[model samples]
Target chain A: MALGLAALLFIVLCALPVFYMLGVSLVGADGAFSLNHYFRLFAEVRQLDLFLNSLLLATATSLLATAIGAPLGVLLARADLPAKRALRILLIIPLAVPPYVMGLAWIYMGSDSGIIAQATGRDFLSPLTYSLTGAVIVLSVSFYPLAMLAAEAAARGVDARMEEAALLVAAPRRVLWRITLPIAAPSIAAAALLIFVLALSEFGVPGLLRVPVFTTEVFTAFSALYDFGAATALAVPLLALALMAGITARFMIGERLLVGRRGARNRSPLSLNSRRAGLAVTIALALFVLLPIAALALETGRAERMILALRSSVEAITNSLTLAFVGATMAALIGLLLGYARARMHRFAGTVDLAMIVAFAAPGTVIGVGLIGLWNRPGLMEEIYRSRLIILIAYLARLIPVAALILAAGARQVPASFEEAGEVAGAKWTRVFARITVPQMRAGIIAAWVVSFILAFGELGATVLVAPPGQATLPAHIYTLIANAPSGEVAALALTQSAVVMTLLALFAVFVFREKRLHS
Target chain B: MNDSFLRLVNIVKRFGRREVVRNLSLEAAEGEVVALLGPSGCGKTTVLRVIAGLEAPDEGEVWIAGRKVASDGINIEGPRARHVGFVFQDLALWPHMTVAGNLDFALASVSVARRERAARITEALRMARIESFASSYPDQLSGGEQQRAALARAIVSRPGLLLLDEPMSSLDTELKGELIGEIAALQRSLQVTTVYITHDRAEAAALAHRVAILREGRIERIDEIASL
Candidate 1:
């Protein structure tokens, strides 16, 4: 009964926004069923431009990310490089630093009065810095880690003996091409498609770089033009694109989307030259991880400015921290029940997985518009919408699906027999869950919370749209300050956000290492 | 011993701090079937890997077909150049390829002429009695058919040495008996130098001309099957 309630809540919180948007998009001004919004979307050249630009960004980002990330993944999985654990963590730091923040760093480095301009006494890079290419670069740098991690896991999952079987007749390179890569191709392709969808759905990087994609266009139509109908129309293309990509990725990845299991103990057939691979890793870290951060610090200039920026944005920062904490807790708790149900489900689990993937893939601006359309009027919901609670609801709408995915992967690791044994001992379902199941999945629960907190903290697209007056989160404040406030203050705030996320990640890593030691 | 086609001398292999194969030595004459029989983790499979150049021993030498393939913690020759055929315990058939495709890949790797490749694959499939399943992927085939496909893939390149590591462990007893008989006949006809690893004494006794019993990481004794 609890599990059923959790599923119902999941649908209500996560799925309803997308459904409401779909329903609204189909209704005309006359309140009759119509396809006029889509018709207008198709007829307008500006809309076509938006579509093409979004497609170009997503495609280029996916291809570049995969090109850079897949080989790095193979190297990490198969090469005899030094300090592998540290290298992986360092590579992943760019992902934890949100794309918008990275965009800010690039702007500081390349804008007319920015670092490069000061260093070179010229404005050579500003054109590329503020263009669509800039958006793609920033988004790719932020998302390639997704592809890298996915490819690493996929490569590691290939049976070592299969490669060995090929090795007996073929060279290591041929074996890698014929045996290892072919087996891992599906997963790597799925990850690329997922990155494509995420790039399409991204609002902040494109918005910051002045790229007029669907997500940014949706935000403009709603906030600047006050044309709700136009915004809803703009969001339809993004929704359809996300749905298609989500279903395809889910099909390609199947149950292994989140559940990572290492294969046998034998060494892989493929091994890269350690020195060359190490050089590549170093260059990547410098370009993607260190450069942007150093730019931020350089622009921020001094410690006092960072403190002053923090003090000025104290309310927003506190709101972000408190809301992320509460939101992550709620998301983790709800995700635990839903994930347990999804994991134990023998039927319709695929359907549930598809729904979660679509919800997670839905662009933030689309969900924000959907939430406004759903709750901006009508008694109780209107009251909630007028208060700070609407921002929390937005967080739930955006984060619950990802939390459930992480927790479901965790839940799948615990065997069913453990619960069955609890039942045989006459323990109630709640007791069994609390004592036996939850204890076993403690690591998953913490991981889910940490992931949720990070996502919610960096969340800007939905929160900016849904926040009540004077209740802005840190991301919203930083975004609004980008154009109005001093560049130094904005850089300091962005740097602060990155620091918080990195500290949390470091702490999580420490916890994991300690757990591994204790268990070993 | 000097004329042995496959030889291991003073092999010592360690994974981390634990020694897995400790100063083990073994030999198989040309066309002879030697079974390294032992309990699980008795280093029999490691010995097969060492001989095939899949692994280099920490303190030993391996000679296959009169070539020093590995010595002093280094692989002098890689697995491909060693011309070895290995059938792993799990079979490890490539799932993405059809049975014929698998055999074709093996033959092509050895630089078999493209014009003769189809006939070689067909001959291998025919020898393994899996000719009708050439178009089928490994997952589409039955357990026994998959085993035959794995065996066909192993011998497709006409390798100089053959290594089998509990290839029939997953099959039922009746099928195991039938496959064992077929394998013995195939070995006799091909005259390939073979090293078979098994924990089952019955399998060792049934097909091996000689059995080397191992305990921990060392050989306890070598017995001629005629004496057994």
Candidate 2:
């Protein structure tokens, strides 16, 4: 009972802000009931423009990210590539960069006092940061990890024996297309939809680049203009779009796509054997993944950069760590409840799980917009909206699904006989769950918490719009510093944030390694 | 006459369009060792699960110690409420838990005080001869150790009925013989009604007081092991 309530409390708190956003969006005018705000979106041209921009950005970004990420995923999962571990880590490192930070990095590369201007002695601001192309680049870089991870997961789930059978029958290419890709298509589509939803609600990249999209419009209406009704109306379109994308993604990729069966084969990276092709791909990867960080490092000399970065480093680290801790703890608790609910409530499990997945697909900024629209009204939430509590709520709504999926997968691996053993020992369901279920899922719970922590710490889109003014997180802080400060100062801050993220990842890697050793 | 400890009457189970366990009847008398022996896909495991209330039968009934727990499409009790213990082929001991914790989790709500629970743990551990490995986690234990741990956990609750599903399948030949001897001794000591399922004819012949051979989801023969 205690465990269940803890789980319930965690889920309720996480879900409250997003649910309240929807509830408030439905509130009527004249101090009564109406769908005026929802209807008003269609009547406004600017709202429609912003809606289209968001849709275009999401669709284009998902496709581009998937296109680039799919080959990389295949190389990592199935090929016998050289330096496999090193390349995998290198490809994944870009994920540690927050979306706003990536935008800031691009700004440094393309702004008036930027690297391109400094290097080429020509102003390139017209085609760079302040355009839609910039927004696409930012969103694509921010989300390609989704595609890569999905492809790898899908490829891993294919039974090696099946592939081997195809190879022996002299149908390698046929098997690759028909058997492998089709079997894993659900996961690839799911990844693309996730990226699409993420791009749809992204606000910071577009905001930084001055590309007007729905999320930015909603942010402007609420925060700048203080027009709650107008903002709510604009957000209605985004909400509908988010729901549509989630449903479409769910249909394209089933729930099983989210949870893959871990296989035992040692995945070897693909060999890029053609000399010219190898060099070309390597150069492309280096440009995409390594060049920005390298420039950030070079622009800021190591000594001066370290000194400036260290000044506020302690405070930023503390804030990021604390928020991540809270978010992870909250997410883990909710994950436990959801996992249990899925396991125990067999009949309604699929539907409830689908709802959670859809909510997960909804982006942080969209949730933030919804929260503001809901709470900034002339009502009880007016008070809550003014506090840091609202930001926490936004984080909860955006992150719980991630933790739940991990926990659910882990929970499923536990055989039913363990629970049965407890019951046969005369333990009630409640007691059995506490003594058996909780203990068995401890590692999964911890892993879920860690994942949530990493994601929450790097979250920029929602935090940029929702965080109380001047209370900048690491990502937000770096973004602002990059816009105004010298190249060295900005690079120092970016490097520091990267270091913090890398350190957490290292710790997590150590835990995973230990677990594997223990199991083996 | 008193009823048998556990009974299954005309149980039928189907998956999709195929019937896995066709109208099958089975019973385990008090303190009797009843072994359901069969080849793969013969539905021995399905029948055992049905009796344990883990799987529902499309037809027929189940009784435990004179009480009808499932019958005529009515399942009045779930697996937890059936007071039945199951030992899976994989052991299914919680891998993250210590050996002692494994036993304690099973005996969670029993009125045993902390000291008494510890004593019970010690007794079960000693009985299973796994006392020295009490603090070790399941993954650290050997296959034989896991077999012992599974048995200790199942019997710790003093269940009215016990079910073992291919208990020695994962063990080596040496460990299998050793564990099988220990299990037979433990069953004799506890006098618990047990229904052991195995595909191995030799195992059933060696351990069961009465052995039932199942073929294609139906009973081919049920007789005393000595006569068989």
Candidate 3:
């Protein structure tokens, strides 16, 4: 019964945001339900342009992220890369850096007095950080890890014996094209779709780069215009696109990759012999990964100037941490219960999992819009929205799906028989869960906790739209700091944010590694 | 003997449209080792689980040590109340548990004193020839050792009827032969009624006093090793 309640809690947490958006999208300034807002969205060419810009940006980011990520995935999974373990770790750290921080780092490099501008003598804003192309570059860098992780996992799933068979009959290129790529297609498509959804919902890069995508327009409507109805209406297209992409990604990646065998840990790393290949990968890493980080670090040295520039970064850090803790705690509790239910009660698992993912795929702006639409009415919920409770609810809405997915992955490894064995031995279901199930899934629980925490900490899209007056999160604060401060201070503050995020992520990675060692 | 220990009457289980265990009925005497032998997917494991109450039959009844655990008209008890011990094919030994923890979990409801529980764990480890490895995790142990740990865990509760579901499938050829004799010896010494399921005919013939071969969810024959 407790498990059931937990599932209901998570499901409601996910649904309320989307429904709230839907309610607000339909309601008008006159406080009556109407279709005029949506009609206005289609009829206005500028609004339509914003929609197109977001769509095109999402498509480009997906392609670019996939193109960059797929080869590296193949290298990591199939080829022998130098310092492979260190490289894998480095690749994942980018994910830990919040998208807004990445934007600030780019701004520091590309701005008029930016380090890159000083060093290269090229106008920083000439072609990047202030245009549509700049948005794509930033979004791709932020989201490529999605493609990298998924493609690598899929590459690992291909039987080495099949590759051997292909090698026996043909050249390496033919074998790769004919057998390996085809086999890894589902995962590749899944990765692309994931990147697409991420790009569609992205607010920070486009906002920082001064591009007016749909998310930005929504933010503008809420913050500047205070037109909650228009903001809610603007998010409808993004939500629909994300939902469609998420569904297709699910179908393409189906149940085949769901159950990973224990033997997957034994994958043999492929060797790369060409020096040119090594040079290419190193150069790519240098340009895309190292450059941004170097710029952020250089900017950090001018700490006094940065401190003078942005006052809100420090307070935003505290608020971000609080919301992150709340979101992580709620997600972990809800995730554990839902994972338990799905593992034990087989009947409703698919439906529950789908509901959670649907909630995740819905854009944060939509959620913010939804919350305002639903609770701005005079009622008990209205009071809750006026407080800190609604912000936490937004975090749950965005994070539960990720927590559930990671936990579910961990829960799958635990054989149902363990629980059955415990029950038959005379323990109650709750006792069995506590004594047997929880211990076995400790690593997964930790991973879920960290994932939700990091995602929550960096969360900006929904917070930007819905954060009550005087309430600013870390990312939102850092963002405002960049615009409000001079180049040196912006750079310094961005560096501090990066350091804190990297430290937390490193600690999480270490914990996960220890858990793996404990289990293995 | 002892009110038929554990019994099943006309158990029917279906997956969507296909019946996996069709009108299957079986019983365990007080201390008999009745091996449910069958080809892959013939529903032998399903029968073992039905008795242990891990599964509920669509259209019949299961009585565990004289208590009605499940029936067509009513479901009386869950797996916990059945007082049954099952050794899964996967050896689903809790990977997080040490050998001692595995045994302690099984013996939780036995009403044994704390000291008695500790003593029973030591005895179970000794009986399974895994005493030296009691502190180790399941993954750290060899396949044969894990099999032994699973058996020790199942038997620690002193269940009236024990179910072994392809318990030796994970072991190597050499360990399989060695452990078969050890398991048979433990069964004889403890005199626990056993329903051992296996697709391996040799294992069924070697470990079972009476082997019942099931084909396509129905029992084809029950015979002694010499007769086979």
Candidate 4:
């Protein structure tokens, strides 16, 4: 019953704003329901351009990320490379860096007086540096780690004997092409679709790169132009696209969405020979990992300026950290209940998962517009909407589905008999869940909390749209600061934000390692 | 006066200090069926892998069809270059491929002409009695049909040597007996040196000219099944 209520509360909190905005979009000036907004959207060439831009950007990002990530995943999982742990650590750190910050770093690297210009005395890439192509490149570098992780898991999941069987009659290359890659196709393609959804839903990269995508248009209509009707209408197409992509990705992955690769230690017969693959891997790491962070540092220049900028932005930093803490706690509690319920459910589970995927994929601009429409009017909700709690609401709306999915994967590992034993001891359902299940899922809960914190810390799309006056979160504030603040200060804040996120991730890893040690 | 088509000269293999195949030596004559019978984990399969060039021995030499393919610490030739047909215990049929496609891939590696490749695949599928399921993926086929397709793929290349590692382990008693008979007849007609590894003594006795008993990574004895 408690778990049911958790799911119910999440649905009600999330559905109301979205449905409100959706309903508002359907109403014409006469306030009667109609499809005129959609009609107008299709009739306008500008709207069509928006759709094409988003589609092309998403496709390019998906393709490029996969092109880089799939081969890298294969090497990491199958090769006998030296110092793999360090390499993985380096590769994964990019995942924690927000794409908008990477866009800034790239800007500093490729601008007229930027790093490349200083080094080579010319800006050869200046023209392509802040265009649609730039957005695709930034988003790919930011998102390829997702594909890499998925491909690595899928590669590891293959049984060694499968490849060995193919090897007997075919060359190694043939065996790889026919046997290994085919087995990992579902995972690779699913990851590509996921990247597509994330790219379509993204706001920061396009906004930073000066691309006129739907998300930017929605922000313009609502925040800048004060045209609520146009904002909701603009959000409709992106909402549909995100939902379609999310559902397609979910189906492509199927039941294994929550099930990761089984044995990561399984060895393949194929060996990584010579230093050629090693040289290529080194160049990739340098391109993806080292270059961006180094650019941020080069732009920031010194520790003293970063510290000074950090001091001046103390309010924004505190607001971000405090709200994210509370928001992540709420997300964890809700995710745990929903995840346990989803894991134990027998029917309608797929439907619930579909709903979660759709909610998670809904564009942040759409969610922000929906929240304003639902709660900006005079009421008790208005009180919450005026305070920092509204920001928490935005975070929960964005993050709970992802947290629940993570927890659900963890919950599935536990045996049913363990819960039954708790019930057999005369414990109530809630008690049985707490003592028998939650204890077993401690690592998952901590992990979900950490992810929630990072996402909330870096959140800008909805947060920018919904953040109360004088209470701007750090991410939203840095974005606003970029327009007027000194270049050093903005770069400093971006670096600080990245540093805080990495520190949190590092702490979480340590805690998880300690928990594993204690358990074993 | 010898007909040793597949030879292993005192091969030693280990998995991180746990010795799996210790100074193992065996030879199969041309058109001969030698079954390596042992308990599970006794490294019978490892020896077959060594001969197939899928694995290199730690301390010995392997010669297939009178060419040294592997020696201590090095493999001179890969499995495909050695022209070996191997049937894994789990069948390992390509799940994405049709039954005919599986056979075609094996034949394709040998650079067979496309026109002749179809006929060879059809002939192999027909010999294995799975010609009806030529268009079906591995998962779509019944267990017995899948077993037949595995056999078809292994021999579709007409390899100089064949290795079978308990290909009928998952089938029931009747299916197993039928497959055993089919395999024996297929081997005789193909006239290729074959090595069959299994834990079942009865299977060894039924399908092999000679059965070699293995215990603790060492060969206990080798004798004709009739003599045993």
| Least accurate 10 contiguous residues by lDDT in model 4 chain A | A265-274
The parts of candidate 4 lying over 4 Å away from their true place are A264-266, A421-428, A508-520
Q: Model 3 compared with the native: what TM-score?
A: 0.67
Chain A (alone) TM-scores for all candidate structures:
0.96, 0.87, 0.92, 0.96
* Structure candidate 2, residue pairs in collision: A28-A34, A79-A268, A79-A269, A81-A269
Each prediction's fraction of true contacts recovered: 0.97, 0.00, 0.00, 0.78
Instruction: Report the Cα lDDT for candidate 3.
Output: 0.76
TM-score of chain A of 4: 0.96
Report the C-alpha lDDT of model 3 over A70-100, residue by residue, as the tens digit.
8777777766666666677677766778877
Per-residue lDDT for A93-182 in model 1, tens only? 888887899999999888887777887899998889989888888888998998898789889989889988888888888888888889
lDDT of 2 by residue, A1-520 (tens): 6557745654565455556666666677675666888777667777667777888888999998898777677656766566655566567666766776677677667766566677689977647677888888877877787788788777877655334322222234554664466657778888898888878877778888888898788777776887666666666666677777777776675556444656725332122244544454476467666666665666667776678676856666566677778877887887787766665566866566666766676556657666665567676676677766666666777778778778887777778899999899999998887789888887888878877887788777667677776566777676566657776777777777666766776676667667877989
Write down the TM-score of every candidate: 0.96, 0.64, 0.67, 0.96
Q: What range of 10 consecutive residues in model 4 chain B has the weakest lDDT sum? A: B1-10
In terms of docking quality, how is candidate 2 classified?
incorrect
Best by DockQ: 1
Query: Clashing residue pairs, candidate 3?
Result: A20-A370, A21-A370, A79-A270, A80-A270, A306-A489
Better of 1 and 4 by DockQ: 1
Pick by DockQ: 1 or 3, better one: 1
**iRMSD for every model:** 0.8, 19.8, 21.6, 1.3
User: In candidate 3, residue A493 scores what lDDT?
Assistant: 61
